[model samples]
Target chain A: MTGIELRGVEKAYGGNKPVIENLDVQIEEGSFTILLGPSGCGKSTILRMIAGLEKETAGEIFINGIDMRGVSPGAREIAMVFQNYALYPTMTVKENIEFGLKNIKVPKPEREARVGEVIEMVGLTEYMNRKPQHLSGGQRQRVALARAIVKKPKVFLMDEPLSNLDAKLRAQIRTDLIELHRNLGATFVYVTHDQVEAMSMGTDIVLLESGRIRQQGAPESIYSAPKNLFSAQFIGSPPMNIIKAENLEHGGASLPPGTVSLGFRPEKVIVSGEGRAPERGQISFRGELVAREILGDHAIYKFKTAFGCIHTKTMSGSTVEYGKWSVRVDAKYLYYFDEKGDVIK
Target chain B: MRSQSGVFWRTFGKACRLAVNLLIFAVFFVPFYWMFLTAVKNLGQTLRLPPAFWVSAPHWENFGKVFDAIPFFSMLKNNLVMTFGIMICQFFTVIPAAYAFARFKFAGGRFLFGLTLATMMIPAQLVFLPLFLMFSKMGLVNSYASLILPWATSSFAIFMLRQTFKQVPQELIEAAKLDNASEWKIIFKLMLPIAKPTIVTLGLITFILNWNDYFWPFVLTTNNAVRTLPVGITSLNIVDGGVKYHILMAGNVLLVAPALAVFLFAHKQIIKAFTYMGGK
Candidate 1:
């Protein structure tokens, strides 16, 4: 088990225009670290560099305190599962899982024993004779996992391995991966553009934006104390709505007077009951409910407020109407951002 | 009631498709039929008024005469040597070159590959005279080196193989690399296995082109020792005794047989190779 550390890693396709610049990250051993961001944020690039698939233009990579300079991907002692699974289509599931073993010159009987063990581990014993194309998306993903883990590599690098599966399968595999990590105790560095995957599966999340680290911490800490506006907006689902609102604080704390963009999570916002007024909440916005989406258990209401548009999720059984509504923002959930979109701590 | 016009239009479409396909097959297979007929026709029956479609007796001895009239065995050997040699050479030259062009990023690779593709558009005739002169200067004009050497380095093979190599997933190659495979193992074990279909197509094409080659052999070789099949057949056209039309046709059948058999068995793969390369 070994941790990966990137120090001042930078990459550019010449021309002095860097794709990833001055990036620093430290991933702990036996920890599932997800480099999460939107597309082209260079999360995948960082993963590739760690796998030695892509060369860093400038930086040093360390694995278990050993400098990983000028090392080829073959010698990296790391296994990577690609977004597409990247299984050898010509080989059967058994052969694909055994490819690395064969390459390392493992003896025939030991290789077969290891392959059989992983096949059962991934629940793919029945599909061992099948090719990758013959397997479903989820099954192929499992075969990829089986192939990676069978090697018992010091590090596992998965680049959006679950993104290709259907929604239900993605969620299912997410649970399976978390369980697998616990049992194996191998260090995992996962990269994904899906914030939900990062938040749910990663023990530590490294939020990236424009090829740089936006924030890094445990999932709960990053979710609650997001270091920046991008980190806050990116970490949640249905996204954190940003409304241009006035900080009309009469007696809170001494603050500068300037327009601030109010950020609050929709799940935290509550619609006041007909006769029951909201208390202990310092913020309330009155607006016309423009639209509503009833998603089985909860209904998300879209409103045109005085500040801007606000979205609040209320229980679907609640008797909220379309015309007028008062949404209460819990004081602790309200985040203020300056005009430049930086979080105003 | 089934509409009369709808039924008529449907029948007409089916007949049109059948007619078009018949025309295509005829256009492709007529020369082969004619060659086969000529190989078995006698001198007098070959020039008969109606152009003999059926003969009274099969002239099996005409094939023997083709061998008797010329050094058929030696000519066959030369053609086989050149064809197989070129094919084997291309297997080596094309696969690695293709892998490099498809998978790696080296300085000037794009410029070099572009230069290779640019050579494809230029006619072989344009380079024939200069290449012949260069080979003569190198004292390689009369040997098999003159025949097989120039073909051993092909731009088109590199181009075809590069397209095939590109279709192999980058992930597989990277996986192989991570397995402690040098680039050589990745090419031989991973890339080659995944690209079996494309490799067969390249081999067939390289064989066909070399077997049917005449102009290069005619220009470079002055004697029958190094002459390929097509060139050998042309020499049989104006032999010392007379125009041995039957013998010429027998030689033609021999020349076409191997290529025809290869194409028939692997036509789907050949067409797919064309489609794959054309798309690129």
Candidate 2:
């Protein structure tokens, strides 16, 4: 059974322009599905629709096979962790955790037990009596997580929950979330603009742009086999470099018809000595070395070529000279896109 | 050397601020001091030339004379009923209205809020004549309802609360909804507590405005049976006979005491509330 399903869902504030236009998504049971997109891409809007916080302008949503057309958010049996960690300011950590249970009329003993268990799970046992103001940013985030989990909702939705934390703390919480997802065995739909978070934690990734799904697949598959130019550029840091097919001087390889753009990941380019012979089905370009950025373990070398600026990632300890250099790209690693930006299969 | 100059400048600024504040306090404090002194002076001493700064023998009996001149207890009762009644009714009306203005998206919401604000600009004198006629037709004159009904919905209170409520993050409301809390629970439990300081400030403002209101109560009520303290105190100013200056001052003192006590109790909250408003 699907944990959550959105069929032809459309959301618009008013007038004719729909933010999310005729979208269909199915989150498989117990899978960690990530809604990944840049800001204002309507990823948070989709999460809100599923939680019944915002109504879809058209179409149906289902949770556990139950239609959620007019269901209140609470009745949908979905819990959401907000970016702001919206723990009730007046309530203590314990009260915030038990708030939903009390509202749903859960018995006293079970509610307390569940609150205690979830609090312990989040490692907030010592800070249970403190209000949200007294807790640090990370601690408040844990309280929000515990509050959502205590309800034991069938699905958990998080809207950039770790974005507010510092880098180290975000990483720590990301690992914690993954482990929690494994232990709970419940569907988790996380929304974030951070590609790193999506790649590290998501079992299935749905990439969105301007409210439309660009690609949906496992992290590795999306990274390796991006279906279009947007997916290629959006999924990677220092994004995929696109070189117009006209600018590239191919090494006697037959070009596909209707190919307007050729793309390759930064790490895919092989930097070698200028005199090295190009291997079979490999293209080589010799260009002036423009700049280099040392990123601890790896160095990114930017070169000015006839095609454009081509960035190559090499090991930091490599003793490569700074003048002219030959950069090689295997034909197999090249991605071709048509004028409409669709991949040329 | 820089630190030394910084300290000197800071102390100089502090001294200037203290001097200015003292000057402002004296301006406001002098009138209250004169009123207190006049309230305690005998009728003979009250009319003395240059006005006695302090009463030699404080006539506390003037306070008793105020009660004798008018039904003070009935007036107190009337004042409490009207002030509290308006406050309670305003709470029920304004909170939901403010919340709607702040959070809900609907057609004409902005226009209606603008209209409510527009009502605030319309002077009370402009509306009182029409309102008084309407009450007279309904035979509500000289009744607590007459005093309470017109002032029940305070536009200032609603406007202040809406601003405060808008500051509450939308995420909090969404979280509450996800927690199975109904709209009522969301307002009273979540929004209300978060807006407590503002509500207290509004309540304090409302209490003082209604308590010290002389014109409306004077126009609305005719006899001692329903007159509030401010209007009731006017009875001490006899038209045919000479005004009992000391007794009237004593009556004014009695009238001002409740508002003064309320302000003292909630001054901290009021200051905090205004600070929040200014910061926002």
Candidate 3:
């Protein structure tokens, strides 16, 4: 069963230009789906539409198999953790977590019990009496999470909840979020522009651009076989290196017709000395070394080849001279795109 | 040698700031000192050539004489009722109006807010005659309602509260909405508490303005039955005869006492409110 479904959803702010147009997505029950895109790509708007904070200018939204056309956000049985946490600054941790329960008029004993349990689950029992201003960023984030979880709603929507934390804390909380999702078995819809978060935490990644869904699938599948040029370049760090297929010296290798560009991941290329020979089913190029950036464990080397400037990630310990070099790519790992940037399968 | 010069410059700057502050303080404090000195002087001492800086014999009777000259307690009661009535009415009227202006998007939201702020530019004197005529036509003159009704909604209060309310993040309101809070609950329980400091500051300003107001009460009331302290004090002026400066100064001191006490206790909050405004 789908936990949430948006059919032909469109949104516009007092103008003919819709921020989101023809957005259709189905979030499977108990799955962690991420709406991934660059800033201003309408990812957050999609989340708000699902939460009923924003009205769709066209089409319908369904949550938990019920039409959400006229449903208030509270009536939809969904809880959201905002990007800034949005914890009530004047309320104590315990009060913040219990606020929703009180608003719904849960009995006193049950409300206290649930609040206490959530406080322990988020490791905020000792700080329950402290206000949000007294808590650190990570602690405040935990309070937001606990506040959302205490309600135990049908769907949980989070809008880049960990973006405000430091790098080390973000990584730690990322793992905590995955564990929390597994333990709760609830549907989670998250929005973020960070490809790393989408790749690491999402069970299904929906790549969006210009308010349209580019692709939706498991993270590994999207990373390995992007359906178009945008997803291929957007989903990876240092991005995919593209070269004009006609510029390549094919060296007797048969080229697919209408192949305007060729793309391959940086990690898939092998850099070697100038005198190296290409192995079977491999294409080799000779290029001048432009620059090398050492990124702790691995290094990225920029080379100016006959095609264009291509980047290759290699082991930092490799003893390659900074001069003329040879790089090889296996034919099976190469991607071909037509003039319109759609991948040629 | 460099560190010594740094110390010298710092000390010189501190001394200059202290001197300027003292000069400003004395500029304001002299008038209050003169009022107190004149209040204690006898009638003969007040008219003396030197204008007795210090009364040779203190006349504490002057304060009592002000009460005898006018219905002082009745006027005090009227002032309290008028000020408190305006304050309460403004709380109800300004908050909801400000919240609507800040949060909701409706037709003419901007135009209506512009209209409300435009009221602040119109001097109160320009509208006094029309307002007085309206109140007299309604048979509201010489009553507390006449003084309180005109100031029931203050544009300045609405504008200040709206600016403060706009500063609240929209996400917080959305969070409250998702938490099952009604619109009124979101306002009274959430927005109001977070904006408590500014609200208190607005209340203090409204109270002080109504308390010190002399013109409106003087225009609206015909007798001492509904007159406030500032208007009632004018009875001690004794026009076309020898003026009783001591008794007049005593009335002035008493008139200034409540406002002075309110400010002394709440100056920190007023300063904080203005600072918060500057920050935004």
Better of 1 and 2 by TM-score: 2
Q: For model 3, how does the per-residue alpha-carbon lDDT over A231-327 read when each residue is reduced to its tens digit?
A: 9999988799998887774655566888888899998999888879999988888998889888888988899988888888876676456899999
Give per-residue lDDT, candidate 3, residue A257: 87
Q: Encode model 2's per-residue lDDT on B1-280: one tens digit a residue.
A: 9999999999999999999999999999998888888899887787789776866689899899887778899899999999999999998898889999999999999999999999989998899899999999999999989989998798888999999999988899999999999988998789999899899899899999898999999999988898898988887887456877878889999999999999999899999999987885
List each candidate's DockQ score.
0.71, 0.80, 0.86
Give the best candidate by TM-score: 3
Please list the residue runs of candidate 2 whose C-alpha ends up more than 4 Å from where it truly belongs after superposition: A250-254, A274-280, A319-322, B1-15, B50-52, B104-111, B239-244
lDDT of each residue in A209-318, candidate 2, tens digit only: 99999999999999999999999999887788898886653645567999889899888889877868889988888787889888889888898887789988876677
Best model per lDDT: 3
Question: lDDT of model 2 at residue A320?
Answer: 57
Candidate 1, B14-75: lDDT as tens digits: 99999999999999888888899889988887777889777768798888887886788898
Residue B271, model 2, lDDT: 98
lDDT of candidate 2 at residue A333, scale 0 to 100? 94
Interface RMSD of each: 1.1, 0.5, 0.4
Clashes of each: 0, 0, 0
lDDT of 3 by residue, B146-218 (tens): 9899999999999999998998888999999999999988998899988888999999999889999999999
Lowest-sum lDDT 10-residue window in model 1 chain A: A247-256
Local distance difference test scores for all models: 0.85, 0.91, 0.92
Best by DockQ: 3
Kindly report which residue stretches of model 3 are placed more than 4 angstroms away from their true locations once superposed: A249-253, A319-321, B1-8, B55-57, B239-241
